[model samples]
Target: MLEFRDVDTFYGELHVLKAVNYKIEQGEIVCLLGGNACGKSTTMKTVLGVVQPKRGAVVLEGEDISRLSTAERVRRGIAPVPEARRLFPRMTVYENLMMGAYTRKDKAAIAEDLERVYELFPRVKERLAQSAGTLSGGEQQMVAMGRALMARPRLLCMDEPSMGLSPAYVEQVFEIIQEINRQGTTIFVVEQNANMALSIAHRGYVLQTGEVMLHGTASELLGNEWLQKVYLGQAEATPAPR
Candidate 1:
């Protein structure tokens, strides 16, 4: 549902995301993984319209949305949960979710989606009136996801959803991500949690120094020798289905 072709991006003259090309198909979960300083996050930002590409295209379905404003992109059904769970600290959980649907005029639909978000995240529902800033890291992440889902996106872009959480929380986040995809939202996620990412992704892409270094099925990448060495610390291990 999303495509990036020959994308080159920069941050104040520091070139990043060099000629990256890939596609995220409908109802598919695709991941971008790499070490620190790689352009994985940059790739996501480019897709979200936070970082504009100097060259190439960011296409959503059939349209080339290279120059679309972020709000415009959201209206077109692209929603993102950024790296740091960006939420209104002082806003109540319910209020935070409502803000996500600000672009929509359908109150009934927004209410239904809010109900679905609560169903997906029970904790948020239980504390709907509580201040968002008071929640734990994991709870806050849930709020972030809930807010993004409020937009009812066709394609969801998640950047480091599992970051800054305990192992248990990380696993929780992954489970939710899987459930979201199973419910038919095409997901393009950038994560450092390689094991979790590759485990659930339909396909994966490895980025490095502003370029795509690897691309294949999730199982193919999970079993790659170089990938094992770089992330799992088993340099000579045999490839095995995850």
Candidate 2:
């Protein structure tokens, strides 16, 4: 489980996150939804320690990791499938997956996890020897997710997993995410596609200008007319759930 407690972060003089707070329970898929510049990706970076918080804490399970290094965070069971599928372009699919286990020392366990990833993304298995850059966008995204899974993270933080994918691929990605959660890894996904994200999420949070404006069970958010208009692109606007 992971929680962001009263976190405040800034980029030089500009404050980007304002007391942002949320929690992802174990075995749950929680989605953070917001428009561009709403600090969705920044939240992921803060959790990963790519950018330290000016105040507050990023707690994993019960330990405060706000001051931990990015590598330490990964070693402590936080792995990311970043937006835009940031993969090693020149690396073969198998090699890229091997990079995810850099923090682990068990070669046997690493090899087992590689097979597990292949099972999850069969397309990746088929392209094991192919260069990552040569794969299709969807295939590359699968590699990114597979690479993160190789780390054996307790909490997998995905930033905009659906960005730039076709609708069919987006649906496929969400299905895989749900399956991954069913297998016991907690997922904290920051997504712009509210409908797709919330469809597979247990709970959802809405962010606006770096503030948490609404949050609730996925069903509650889906039915809320206000969220439907503001983020879900529906015609009616109802009172937002608190």
Candidate 3:
């Protein structure tokens, strides 16, 4: 559903994404794995048009959306579950979810989508009147996912969906991600937890120092000696070629 072609991005003169290339097919869950400052989040921002590429293009469903505004991208069915779940602190949970539908005017469909989100996250429904900032980290994450689903996105872009949470919550969140993908919304996840990300991803890409170092199916990545030694912590494994 989305493809990045030799994309290069920068903040002033400091290059962040260097000729990064990858693709997310419709109905597939693709995860991008990397350590700190390796340009994982920048890839997400590039997809959402928060940062434009200096070279190459960001194509969505065959269209060159390299220059499209963020709003336009959202209208075209791109929704983000931003890192840290950036919800409106003072807004009620219900109101926060409604913001996801800001670009749409189909009242009935929006209501039905709201119900769908509630079904997916009963905790959110229970806390509809509660302020978003008052929820626990896991609850907040659930709200974030529900908010993205509120948009009825065709392709959901999730950035660090497991950034901060207990181990149990992390497993729960990844399970929910798989469920979402099973329900037909393609997912592109940027995560540091390579094991968890690849465990649920159909395919995975490893990004190191702003470049894709490896791209393969999930099982192939799991069996890669280099990836195991570095990301998966199999210290005894021999290094494989980049």
Candidate 4:
């Protein structure tokens, strides 16, 4: 449902994403894996229109959305669960979720979506009146996911969903991600945790120094010696051809 066609992005003179290309098909979970500063997050920003490509296009469905505003992208069915779960600290959990529906006017539908979110995250529903900042890391992440769902996104872009949390929470989150995909929303995840990301992802891409070095099905990536040695911490594995 989304495609990055030969995209290049820059931060002034420092090039970040170099000729990056990938496609996330509808109803698929595609994961992008890379080390620090390798343009994984930049890919998410480009999709959200927070970072425009200097070359090529960011296509959603069949249209080029390279020049669209972030809000316009949201209206066109993109919702983000940001890297740090950047929630409004002072806002109540319910209020934070409502912000995701800011671009909509249909109250009935919004209410129904809210109920769906509550069903997915009963903890969030229970803490509807609590300040978002007071929640634990796992709780905050759940709130973040719920908020994005409030937008009824066709493609959910998650940046570092496993960044901070205990192992149990990490497993829970990935399970929820799989459940979310099973329920029919396409997902494009940018993550550093290669094992967990690839475990649940249908397909995966590896980026190195701003370029795609490997692209394959999740199991193929898992069996790749080079990927295992580099990202999965299997130092004894031999390198494999890209």
Candidate 5:
């Protein structure tokens, strides 16, 4: 549903994404995995139109949206749960959710989507009137996901959704991500947690120093000796199906 073709991005003279090419098929969950400074987050920003590619295109469906505004991208069905879940700290949970639908005019549909978000995140429902800043890390992440869903996106882009949470919370968040995919929204997530991310991904790509080093089915990557040694920290251990 989304494609990045020969994308080369930079921050002034500092080259970041290097000829990056990948595709996120419709109704599938794809993940980009790497450690810090691997250009994973930059790929997400490129998709959201926050960082334009100096070369190549960002295609949604069949059209090139590389030059489109962020709001236009959102309207075209790209909703992102950005790194750090940048919520409106002072706004109540409900109000923050409302802001997600700012691009829409259909009140009835917006209300329905709100209820749908509440259904997916009961904790968010419970904290409807609470300030977003007061919520726990896990709760705030839920609020972020719920808010993104409010936009009714066809493709959801999440950057490090498992960051800064307890192990239990991380598991819960990955499970929620799977559920979201099962509900038919395509997902493209960039993560450092390879084990957790690949456990739920339909396919995975390994990025290193702004380039794709490997790409394959999730199970194939999970079983790769190099992948295990470098990312999973299981050198000399046999690969087992997750």
Candidate 6:
């Protein structure tokens, strides 16, 4: 589980996150929804130790991880599938997945995890020797998720997993995410695909200009006529969830 309490993040003194607060319970899938540049990604980066928080704490399980290094965070059971599907373009699918488990020392366990990943993403298994860059966008996203899973994270923070994908691919990715959660990993995802996110999330948080504006169960957020207009895009909102 992860918790962000009154957290503030800055991009060179231009404070982007304004006292953000949220919690992701163990084995739960929580989605953070917000418009572009509203600090959703920044909040994630802070959790990953990519950007240092200027205020408050980023807690993992029970310890304060705000001051931990990114590698340390990853070693301490945190992994992220970034928005860009951050794969090494020239690397083979198998190689990309192996890189994720570099922090671990058990070769046998690593091999076992590799097999599990292949089972989770059969496309990756079929193209084990293929260059990651040659795969389709959806396949690449699957590889990205597989790579993260190889790390064996307790809490996986995925930033915009469905960004820039076709509707079918988006559905596929979301389904895989749900399956991942069902298998026991906690997930805290940030997404622009509000309908898909709400549908899959157990709980949801709406962010506006770096502040949490609404928090509710997925069904509650989805069924609310006002939220549907504001986020489900039935009507205009203050900013683009772009």
Q: All models: lDDT?
A: 0.91, 0.94, 0.95, 0.95, 0.94, 0.90
Give each prediction's root-mean-square deviation over alpha carbons: 4.1, 4.2, 3.7, 3.8, 3.9, 2.9
Estimate the lDDT of model 4.
0.95
Task: Assess the local accuracy of residue 108 in candidate 4 as a C-alpha lDDT between 0 and 100.
Answer: 99
Looking at model 5, report the run of 10 residues with the lowest lDDT sum. Answer: 232-241
Tell me the tens digit of each residue's lDDT in model 6 across 1-242: 78998998888869889998998899999999988988889878998999999999999888999999999999998998988898999999989998888788988888888888888888889998999999998999999999999999998889999987899999989999999999899999999889989889999999988889899999989888877887798775468677
In model 4, where do residues sit more than 4 Å from their true spots?
A: 236-242
Which residue pairs clash within candidate 4?
none
Worst 10 residues of 6 by lDDT: 233-242
* Model 4 Cα lDDT, one tens digit per residue, 1-242: 89999999999999999999999999999999999999999999999999999999999999999999999999999999999999998999999999999898989999999999988888899999999999999999999999999899999999999988899989999999999999999999999999999999999999999999999999999999999989998786557879
Q: Which stretches of candidate 6 lie over 4 Å from their true place?
A: 236-242
> Alpha carbon lDDT of residue 15, candidate 5?
94
- TM-scores, in order shown? 0.95, 0.96, 0.96, 0.96, 0.96, 0.95
| Candidate 3 residue-wise lDDT at 66 | 99
Kindly give the number of clashing pairs for every candidate: 1, 1, 0, 0, 0, 0
Kindly report which residue stretches of model 1 are placed more than 4 angstroms away from their true locations once superposed.
Answer: 236-242
TM-score of 5: 0.96
Clashing pairs in 6: none
TM-score of 2: 0.96
